[model samples]
Target: MDERFEIFLVATPGLEAPLAAEAAALGWQPVVGPGGVTITGGWADVWRANLWLRGATRVLVRVGSFRALHLAQLDKRARKFPWATVLRRDVPVRVETTCKASRIYHAGAATQRIERAIAEELGAPLAPDAALVVKVRIEDDLVTISLDTTGESLHKRGHKEAVAKAPMRETMAAMFLREMGFDGSQPVLDPMCGSGTFVIEAAEIAAGLAPGRSRSFGFQQLASFDAAAWETMRTAAAPRPAPAQFFGSDRDAGAIRMSLANAERAGVAGLTRFDCRAIGDLQRPDGPPGIVIVNPPYGARIGNKGPLFGLHAAMGAVFRERLQGWRMGIVTSEGGLAKATGLPLESGPVVAHGGLKVRLWQTGMV
Candidate 1:
């Protein structure tokens, strides 16, 4: 169970840099790549990665790899794999395959071969909807097999049940916070706080709460899982006080309601505040000015940027007049809309979100 292997932390495409930085800060030797970060460790490290990483979409363990130029070779190699050491015979498993510049170019055929090998050789039941997934990649005649150790996506967080339209995922929100130089000491405010993602994420970080504290992961279903050891690791994360307050507001009363509910479910309601008001009514909180981040409507889906541009300009004016000392981060798809903020902003990475590409613009000080 302590066999060292490659652990891949899947990032949200453009957010790979921040995710790698986070892994490095956690004392892991993170190697940055295109879609994720790579670290090497054993099963305990796998559990810890699932329990600690807020920016990761999922965690995968590369258990084995070999050269298989054809379907028969792939089948023979997969049958010879030590699946019993990594996968349970009783737990249902799903196999997904992909081919890139490889001799085994048919993904469906590869999937069938792997599934047959696991089912007949290892006697593990195969199901399409299984929680435990075995991922296969045939790239350049090399067959790489990995296990999806983090199930149900880390963004679920096992807390918030309700979500608003185009709501930002918790993982993305967290990485975005890291990009803005947040260190849990300064307050965070989100005016268009749909479902209170940013504010609640900030509060959790400030309070030293593990993002995966309330959730279950796919690693628990693997054969290598040790229940007692996992319990110790999961329960080791202790919470601390959030030094500064977090604030969220929205013009829609229902949005504010959702925000309040989400904050409460996330156990950060006491440290966070949600108000129903227009952006114009936003006033800087009494304490020290901290950071203001907003995910305004991109208007790309609506096919209209006229009103959105005006809204951005108005929001910018309100920030200039009201929240004078705070820094700002604005996320939107339209360059026109972000520029309309009229703040001295520098552009960050372009991230893929819900089929649309969005960029984060950061300002030094309002």
Candidate 2:
């Protein structure tokens, strides 16, 4: 395989900007485009992106591409491509196909051709439930092949076994924290901290911990993987102490228990605390003020709107009274419900989370 190829960092719709910013800040000149931020590098870049990028859903290496205007041409090209350079003959892989503005538009037929090419020619077994996936995109009559270098979604994080209803994903929470101007130098508190995702993400950022430290990635199974070099890169940086503590609170005792357990599993229990308390009972901790980010129950997700307005209004009052001088971010499905909080909040772009369209409402200080 060539030492250089394209690495695509997949982002959810409307979130490609922040992910690009993060990639650029991490020293890669990222090209912002639809589907993701793309960069050109080698296998090490693939490994590093999976380890360092918290906002990407999965990192894909665009290995090769070709032009095929018909099904027979695609079958011929697929059989001749150099899959053995990156894919192992022993590892099993699954094939998925998508066609856009292409003459050869039978996606199922295309999938079959590639599957047979790899299975029969490359000597790799094809399985329906394989961990590795070879994604084929036929766009503008050009066949683009990419390997899913990230097996599971990056949000898994290999920790946080417990999850609450309508839970915020770790990837979204991390990007939201960055959007709220969090730099890991101040405290972070989540009032409705379900499963402690926001708090754990904040604490991890503060401690300079890599998001993929506790997990293995699909890139490790690729033929080009360099174990010694990856190990050296992974262990070169040690985690440092957080500048300030992180806190989470919830009305449900079970939620608090879940938060504590999740934090412990994430190795941030020493820098975080979970309390079983209502929003009304929340008081500022004795430290420098920071960001207050919360993902409260959305009316659409819960099938109840009557109580939510009141809940938001009450929560707004609590923030006004107790959380002054702290910047606030609230994630909710309805703008009306978020405005009911009555903070000086401006709306961010709509993000798709847990099958619901949600936005992040932010304020200067509260």
How many backbone clashes are present in model 1?
0
Tens digits of lDDT, candidate 1, 45-127: 99999999999999999999999989999999999999999999999999999999998899999999999999999999999
Residue ranges of candidate 1 with Cα displaced over 4 Å? none
Looking at model 1, the pairs that clash are none
lDDT comparing candidate 1 with the true structure: 0.92
For 72-166, candidate 2 gives per-residue lDDT tens digits of 99999999999999899989999999999999889999999999999888899989999999999999999999999999999999987999988
- Reference-based TM-score of each model: 0.98, 0.98
Best by lDDT: 1
Relative to the unseen true structure, what is the C-alpha lDDT of residue 233 in candidate 2, on a scale of 0 to 100?
Answer: 89
Error of 1 at 169 (Å): 0.9
TM for candidate 2 is: 0.98
Number of backbone collisions per candidate: 0, 1
